[model samples]
Target: MESPGRYRYRPANTLYAASHDWFSPYLSRPVRELLDAGPHARSLLRSPRNVDVCILFTDIRGFTDLSRTIGSDRLFRTVDACIGRQIRIIEHYDGYVDNFTGDGLMAVFEGPDMTDSACRCALEVVSRALPAVRYGEAALAPIGAGLHRGDVAMGTLGCESRLTHTAIGDTVNRAARLTGFARGRDVVISERIRRGLSAETAARFAPVQADRRRTDIDAIAPIYRSRCG
Candidate 1:
């Protein structure tokens, strides 16, 4: 059996003055307050609203091969650790995690500075998490992130008993596809993301090489790549 500390996950932020809520790590403060704001907010939750948000997708590089070598149990623990750390970073930028996709996770950011905050968070994840999670040569993989900013249909979906609140649309789909091109501490961005950034923030990224560009994403806008540098 694993030790009590082995799987014990504590979030960086406390939900209240005395006790920490287990769901705190999963929902951002705005989202929680919106839900708790009473009956007047029901329509916002029940109806699909079109909103602009920055979508970020992050994956562990070479995770499949690492899992093959380290086995599933260890990989599970590693993923848990990495994601726990990232959730703090995401929340710091006012973003909420959408879901975890095996070795990766999808996060969403909104509000005025969403694009810039998402970019900074992605950079920090690659730079900060790599050194923290590293163990020997094959223990952990570097993080890669892809970001896109656009309109998405945000709403709840499912039966009354089981429902999921999420953002869906081409913007979210493009973000996931852009992540496929990221590798080893790299942050990839769609053209829309780059355009949304402040000039100073945009300076950190460069257009992806022609050979690296995907026709589909380019049809929307070109892609850019940035390292922690």
Candidate 2:
């Protein structure tokens, strides 16, 4: 937890427009009139759009094969449980559950010293799912996670019936790619997010044994996070 004295913040007074779009205008109001001068705000407000330093994706491995074997009714139920456990873990770490896409989730953590926290969140998310899963015997196989810390365009992606307010950039793509690279329950964090990690946390991750032959077995992108040192 950060000290309360570290941050100062105020919410831009928001008003819903006649057109259904919303707007907030900064006026002559004193800085003391702020919304959530919480400790997290100091770091969250650093980048106007992207206080987000991490984007993690955790998907049940072999979902496709399972779907074919189990049939739709049982499969969707299984996927829901798998994703639900991950969402709960992400929220516990002060991370936002951006969206749940089928069996996976995109989580965004906004707070101070986020790089270290994000790494911990990813580990926790994968750890929690193992115990939460139950019959019809759904288990998390090869939990994959991608992490990146940087500025990303953030906003409501749509309106009315459908919407997603999320982080968008190559950083996000790269993280997802890292997840895709993971094998046998690998965490698969990227170079960028790895660099952001505290020295102690960085020590936890091991290097990907170089695949010089370019084999099909470990193909996705480059880089992967296998274990904690």
Candidate 3:
């Protein structure tokens, strides 16, 4: 079994020796096509592309406390179980896991309705992934997430011997920062996401002011939140 808290993409078929570590097995077919083009395609990893995408970051609340309370074995088991289930949920929503962040993970959703898809995926994580595991008497009840939609520079960064594919730019940073404001089972989102939502979907969230005085992104715009029901 894979070690706890370690997230690596595994494709369904036998691993290709050339791109085994460079590409994620969970990458969307469209992304895979782009990567398979040729050596020139590798440049795209460094150049930021203006593509519509929703970035979702989910982390376990009070993880430090939980880790101390639970033994290492149990903690690892809990994290592995929760993250594994979350990855499946993301795949179901046409999204892919980008990387694992300690007790949490980041996923990217693309397509016409990427924001909407990301929101649904975040909700599902709160609903399913949290309840799916229990360590001793404690349940993973609260999972905080932040979702944002905008253009991001998606590419890989590393030297000749190693390559890591990831998304960067303000959009990605904003999504990650927004997670700091999330509490309990809250799914916090940005105005960029709100702008892309339809009326019905927009109604699901309640607006709240986020303290961004310390961050680089615009703080004037309001952040939104929705509780898992």
Candidate 4:
């Protein structure tokens, strides 16, 4: 107990320093175990397994004007509420809300059931957002959503200050660009995603892009769906 110039690690008492300084006896057992694992803590704590399928993005429609009327403080509150609610909706359907890009939300659905789950979450979140509009709760402008399905690499990225947890690949960006092209209350579906959905789900959308090529008008065919029940 009086040794000097030396250190000891007792798995039950002293955690190894290689654990990123995160391990401490003060932490709960589960938490301590997580920390002891160091860099791989993220995987041990990960909520869902990765799936390569599709991403959905939705943006508020008339946000600029609403922001002008409400001013930044109130506008920020409204934006937070909208994004927060959407996140809950995404998680409830077993999907993850990947990122919040300003006035829009980007989410991913993974696993064998990713397609149906992603579509349902997208549809329901859009439906739920409508009520917030009536109360002017979000000061929301309008909502345009898009869904696209394809092979995409999904994982964690970066170290420290630049750390980002999201999916990468053209399908991700294409979903964003596709969402950007929708008008008020419209959900745009890419051809590939349209095929993945059920006939009932597929019936809800019209062709937006026969090909992903960018046209001057962006020539996305329109799709309309009633509020999901």
Candidate 5:
């Protein structure tokens, strides 16, 4: 057995370390605050709850095409750096990252201003990824984002040894489908999201014209596109 001194319980040290640990960045601010107060995994995820939140999904437009032009090593680094920047912007707007898909990410925003926060974050994400800064021999591609707001089941899954915190339901699906519809440097928002925005914010987005392409998708009609970026 290892010596007790090698890893003795130290509340202060553990709290400080936990706040800066790799896993900490993945947690929502409220969850991090809870863990900081009582550093316990059980308490952190004991109860599942339904929450009203804005979900945003972003993906690099034409990523598959971009991938073919770059080496794997450079592609990996470029994507990592790009995602890191987007995550910072998400947190800045009081949002939490849900998951990352190699060239994109899903984030959640809650609270009274969740709609505004998610909208602003999506716009910024598009703008931030617009500049093709060199990453060795490759560059990050411009991204497309989508936002929707609705109720979702938020909780942890899996056994004690390995748990994953995620949100599920039609709300999540719609947001992702909206992302698929977004064009490069565009922020596509569902009607629900557009309705939630403040007047001034809502005015910034233009209604997406209905076309055969969009009409074919389920529940994706009447979306709005923000071209601010």
Candidate 6:
């Protein structure tokens, strides 16, 4: 017969340890704040904070066809390298990476100089990251980017067990939509972003007629493109 003392139970440290491990990966200040709020997290979702931010989105041009031609191992290595370099440059210019989008990424720059910072980051991606990335015999495909500035709702959204801190609103959608109009090595910006730029920065871009007849965004707002030498 087994004695009762032989089956002594340990405290619930395992459960606590598992939870810590799960949340530890997302230890950024913003994510930590959401996790610390506990029950208040629900209220935060209902009334998300509003902030003026410059949203930047970038994607590799013709990535679909390119992926089909390249081996998966080589393809992923090239993509990872390209994205890592781009992200480093973005963070260097004080921008925050929001999320990765398959062959692309979304990021944001806030504060009074958000527009200028975002523009500089985009230019750097064109001149630096794009040129450095390569596959076997092919140079990395050109990147298409878009930038727009507007107020967006930022907060945690998801079920209690798994929450994600993200920004959402028309501004985000518009920025994403604008990226579709961008072609190889093109950096397009909304009129609002252009207005926020300093004189010299504004002079770097030229107004371009974007074919928005198929898209849902406002076609009246002029789009501008910048080229890197």
Please give the CA lDDT of all the candidate structures.
0.76, 0.61, 0.77, 0.65, 0.78, 0.78
**Candidate order (lDDT):** 6, 5, 3, 1, 4, 2
Answer with 3 or 5, whichever has the higher TM-score. 5
- For model 6, how does the per-residue alpha-carbon lDDT over 81-192 read when each residue is reduced to its tens digit? 9988988999898786787899999998877678998998997886677766776686677898989999999876778688667889999999998888788887889999
Cα displacement (angstroms), candidate 5, residue 75, comes to 0.7
lDDT of 5 by residue, 1-229 (tens): 2212212232333563355788866665545554543455455466677888899999998889889999887888788778888888998998888888778999989888899888988888899754645765566667999899999998777886887778888899889988877887889998899988899888889987645655435643688998675
The TM-score measured for candidate 2 stands at 0.69
Q: TM-score winner among the candidates?
A: 5
Model 1 residue pairs with clashes = none
What would you estimate as the lDDT of candidate 3?
0.77
Per-residue lDDT for 175 in model 5?
A: 92
* Residue 78, candidate 4: alpha-carbon lDDT: 77
> Per-residue lDDT for 182 in model 1?
86
- Candidate 4's displacement at residue 228, Å, is 8.6
Model 4 steric clash pairs: 61-142, 62-141, 62-142, 208-221
- Candidate 2 vs candidate 5, lDDT winner: 5
Instruction: Write the residue-wise lDDT of candidate 3 on 181-202 in tens digits.
Output: 8898888899889888878778
Model 2 CA lDDT for position 164: 41
Q: lDDT of candidate 4 vs native?
A: 0.65
Which segments of candidate 4 are over 4 A away from where they belong? Answer: 1-39, 42-51, 133-138, 208-229
Report per-prediction Cα RMSD to one decimal.
8.2, 8.3, 6.8, 9.5, 6.6, 10.0
Model 1 stretches astray by more than 4 angstroms? 1-20, 23-31, 39-43, 135-137, 210-216
Residue-level lDDT tens digits of model 2 in 1-229? 3223223444333412222323212210111122233453334433336445577877777877767777677777777777767766776776666666677877776667677788888877666665656556555454667676666776445556864445788777767766666665567776667777888788778867535565533354446475731
* Two-way TM-score contest, 1 vs 5, winner: 5
